[model samples]
Target: MLKFVKHNLETIAGVEIYPIISLSIFFTAFVLFTVWAMTYSKETLNTVSNLPLNDDESLTEKHNF
Candidate 1:
């Protein structure tokens, strides 16, 4: 698979711009997604993975029980 992609990209562009373009796009998207997740994810890492809820409330409860 890699060989085929490399061969085609080199042949088409004379220097393999496809791989560079693909990597740039992937890194940009990954950074954007990480930023979005850190800023906007509803379930924070602290709350979801570390902190315990109060005794009066059950995590499965439909309301603030």
Candidate 2:
């Protein structure tokens, strides 16, 4: 099954560039996200990190159906 797929891909023109383009896109996004995370605010990070454990009454009131 792998051999059949490889043979079919080899027959297609310009198919090789698809992998390079996809890899470039993934690498660019990964680097940008890494930079953003490195520079993110520490105070905001603390607030967001505690969101799940927060039990404020207003939050519960807003979400009540």
Best by TM-score: 2
Off by over 4 Å in 2: 57-65
Best by lDDT: 2
Q: Each model's TM-score?
A: 0.45, 0.80
Query: Across residues 1-65, which tens digit of lDDT does each residue of candidate 1 receive?
Result: 99997777667644657568999999999999999887975665544543355443455363332
Candidate 2 structure quality by residue, lDDT tens digits, 1-65: 99999999999999999999999999999999999999999977776676689877675465451
Query: How many steric clashes does model 2 contain?
Result: 0
lDDT of 2: 0.85
Q: Which ten contiguous residues of candidate 1 have the minimum total lDDT?
A: 56-65
